[model samples]
Target: MRVYTLFTPSHKGLYEDYFLKTLPDEFELHATELFEQECPTGSFYHEGWDKICYRKVELFVAACEESMGEHFFYCDVDVQFFGNVVDLLVREIGDFDIACQDDVTAYCSGVFVCKASHTTLAMFKAMKRNYNREDQTTLNEHLHMCQHKKLSPAFFTYGRVAARPWSGERFRVPENVLLHHANFVIGVENKKQIMDYTREKNFS
Candidate 1:
């Protein structure tokens, strides 16, 4: 099992450095930085309302294909691992395509596990071809299209998790601790504090 992440200039780096430091040395870690140079507007997308989503998904598919692992995981930089996540993932959902919950269902496509098999590749291609160019909308649509087929749910986790009095212990432990960290900027300072406290006690 390996870990993968995508980032742009806009994304901050403390969280990425933190995660790289935290993962066990045994697990392979990979990352692809998406910059304007590589994704010059015309390369990934034509300027339009859908440009952002199209560019992101297109880049993701390209990276997954080029990566040299039998299994590829798409993880958000903000998502941190507090425990031995590789062990947990192997134990629960080995060699499967796992996706995050899309839309108001909670979370974004911040994490996913792909098998890299022929069928899985086909599904990914389908995603590129049928992409609605609206992340949530396209992802949900892809999830449905891949149902019980190659693409299946490996796990769904809460997005932007941070230890807080308001969160109680519930947010700290999930039914599945596949990924945990802050996604959006709202409540970030507080989230950072909570994350720091948890890392001191739990992650390191």
Candidate 2:
């Protein structure tokens, strides 16, 4: 299967390079500019990157709709898969239009899945409406819809973190799921050091 990731000019090559090193050779990586350059730079989640954030997400959802593939997995660059995700997805989930990790507390949005279909396209349009540059909110609405049967969860197996209701595991993914979100917020010098360390070790 093909794997896709959205990254901006700020992402540099380290993140993509590490991703290439981590996944199996069969999983091809496709890179694209996450958003249109013309989108206005406004107050985007206090990061001033909000305009691009919304556009990029919509772009991904739209692209997935026309793709003639078996599955489309959407991932954030700041997060990384720590286990054999393809094996996990291949072994545990199948034939789903869309799947995503449930934010039981209304928070997480690091990963999600979708199958190529027009229904998914409509859903993406709805999700994009009234978007506040806060991706989690849009995803939360979709997750809630899935919970209510307007959407189907069977088509989606939320990540292991949301499986806690059935498995009794902790909510924090670094401990419970096959992935981890390193919300690294160190100073510039420390950030550089960490990046350098990651480059040296290839932890990705």
RMSD of each: 6.4, 7.6
Per-residue accuracy of model 2 over 1-204 as CA lDDT, tens digit each: 556666655553435554444555555666565444433322224454566667656765666665645666666554444455665554443655555554444434545555656666666667787575666667666644332111212212224234232222222223223443322322223333443443333343
For all predicted structures, in order, the TM-scores are 0.64, 0.62
The TM-score that candidate 1 achieves is 0.64
Q: What residue runs in model 1 are displaced by over 4 Å at the alpha carbon?
A: 37-53, 67-69, 94-96, 99-107, 147-178, 184-194, 197-204
Tell me which residue pairs clash in candidate 2: 44-50
lDDT per model vs. reference:
0.51, 0.49
User: Which candidate leads the pack in lDDT?
Assistant: 1
Candidate whose TM-score is highest: 1
Candidate 1 clashing pairs, residues 3+ apart or interchain: none
Backbone clashes under 3 angstroms, per model: 0, 1
